[model samples]
Target: MTSPAELLALYDSQQRLVVPEHPPAGVTFEVTDGVMRVTGRGEGFVETTQHLGLSGGELDALIAKHRDHFAARGEAVEWKTRAHDLPADIPQRLERTGFEAQEKEAVLVGHTSDLLVARPLPAGVVIRETNDHNDIVGLSTMLSEVWNDDLSWLIEQLEAQLAAAPELTVLFVAEAEGTIVSGARIEFTPGSDFAGLWGGSTAPAWQGKGIYGALAAARAQRAQQRGVRFLQVDASPESSPILQRRGFVEITSTTPYIWSPSAPLGTQS
Candidate 1:
């Protein structure tokens, strides 16, 4: 069992090291006014902040700066705020500055050992890990249905990452009768004991049949096999109770604030 303090420390350290507000390939990343801003491809955001103790005037200026940065690119920006972030009033400041708060999520952490318990898979369901192009496409398609959005961006991003650093990301899918029904991915951070679980989704018809639990168990086993000690997820309300039942404890909360241009640039409104 991991203590809350230990979990917080782990989260902070990982954020500073592996998951810092750095840009991925083809994205422009910059740091100004203690904020890390990233702009790219219909997506822009303040990825991280440091030591920001600003007066209201400064906050307004900073907000305008971010708005201009994304407006020029015609992208919607998301600022991810954690409960433990410094100055304590950042979320309120963001709301006042025109950022709309999205859903709040529980930051759940658990020891890999606790998550490795065996679970029986539903009949005709098969779980496998693969990097084959077809498998990636299938996984992405299943996720797109689950998320009700075009996840082709995710497919491209995953392929790029896998090509560059195959070991850094792993994709798992649950198939029934040769058709993909559920999927998820795990990202291993270099030089850290943490592996993040993301994109865990099941087809609507496939939910509540133990496919998700089976996927969780498989990912946990893989994490432990990779010598990772901790597994972390920013869990949605629907998934929080499921994970809690599997030994994940809530460590913190996170909310994403989004800002989009009134009309996307280059598009007729």
Candidate 2:
């Protein structure tokens, strides 16, 4: 297991810092006053500064700067603040500035060995790992159906990431008659104890058939194969209990603080 500070650093350096999609031309990134601001004409987001030591007033000034940018563009922004962020009172400031809280995800961390790897798949579903485009596209489409979003860009991003880091990522699909019905991806964070289970889902009709469990098992098995010791996920409500049943413990709760011009800027000083 990684130390809490090392785990935090891993998340900061390897995950949160990645801008998966290139923001538009006007969109920009900066770190000022202990805040990381991603601003653009129509959309923006802010996060606690990266590993920098700052006083409370500096952090507030950072938030204030982002607020000003969004005010000018009339855009909505999301602030991703972790529980470990010093001065937990930061969220209080955001609330004063019109950012409303949303669902908090359970951050589940478990040893890869803790995962039970024998869940049976649905009657007609079979699991497979693929480097083929057709298989990846099918998996992407199934995820889009489950998440109810246009996930073409997600597909592209995953493919690109896999191509760049082939040995560190695994994309698995549960297919029936050549059509994907469930899927997930496991991304290995090299030189670290952690591997991530991302984008897990099953088709509506395929739910409760143990497909999710099987897919999760497959990901865990692969993580173990890669010598990874820990598996972590920011699990949604539906998956959290199931993961708990599988012996994964919920460690922390994380919620994204979304700020939007569409929302009321209540009580801002």
Candidate 3:
């Protein structure tokens, strides 16, 4: 069994403070003072080093600067901070600077081999990899129906990602009788030992049928084939429990502090 401390250490050392190997077209990246900013996709994000030794004033200054960076582009932004990150007041500072906290997720880490064992899926449910335009659009439509949100944006994003590097992102869908019941994807960070599992939502009728776990196992199998050491998930409350039962360890917690121009200034202030 891997300790949470060791998993976190491995994650911080390899995943953080590294620039992307192949940035997609029209997407740009910048790193300064141990903070990395990704922009030019209409929605930008900020990722940081594991530790920052800034004082209160310095922290506030850093937040305001990145906040302005996105504001100038007329784009929304997300700042990802982990619970174990230093300067515990990071979230407070972000809120004070007009960022609103979104969903809280468990930082789940587990060895891929632990999940490689076979998982049985319900009859009539077939899991398959999809990158075709029509299939991608169908999968996006299915996800929007599952979440009751307009997630059409995913269509273009997924297309761009596949176009840029097919090896980095893989999308899988659970199909039943020609209808898309569930969709999910695994993302491998370039040159890293970890891969991320994202977007495993099933249709209302498809929930509780073991499809999600099957998708996870499939993704983990792919990760193992790629020589990945661990699989990571920023799991929601609903998913955290399920993943926890499957040998995944909760190393820490993370919440995205997001800011949008359409929203008010100081929404969290």
Which candidate has the top score in lDDT? 3
> Which regions of candidate 2 deviate over 4 angstroms?
1-57, 64-77, 260-268
Q: Lowest-scoring 10 consecutive residues by lDDT in candidate 1?
A: 15-24
- Model 1 pairs whose backbones collide: none
Better of 1 and 2 by TM-score: 1
The true-structure Cα RMSD of candidate 2 reads 4.4
Which tens-of-lDDT digit does each residue in 1-269 have in candidate 2? 55555656666665554443433344467765556677653457777644446446665665667777887887778888767666777778778777888788887877787774766766778998876788888877887887788776555656666776678778888898878898888877556667889888888988888888888888888887788878888899999998888777765567888777777765644
True-vs-predicted CA distance for residue 51, candidate 1, Å: 4.8
What's the lDDT for all of these models?
Answer: 0.78, 0.74, 0.86
lDDT of 2 at 171: 87
Best-first order by lDDT:
3, 1, 2
Model 3 spans with C-alpha error above 4 angstroms: 267-269
* Tens digit per residue, CA lDDT, model 3, 2-118: 688988888898777666677777778899888999887768899788788886788888888889888888989999999999888899888888889999999999889767764
lDDT of 3: 0.86
lDDT of 1 by residue, 1-269 (tens): 56988888878767542443333467666766567776654567685553477756666667667867777767788888888777677777777666788999999988888778756888889999977888778878887887888887777777766665667788888999878899888888887878999989899999998888888888999999889989999999999998888788998898998878773222110
Q: Candidate 1, which segments miss by more than 4 Å at Cα?
A: 16-24, 28-34, 49-51, 263-269
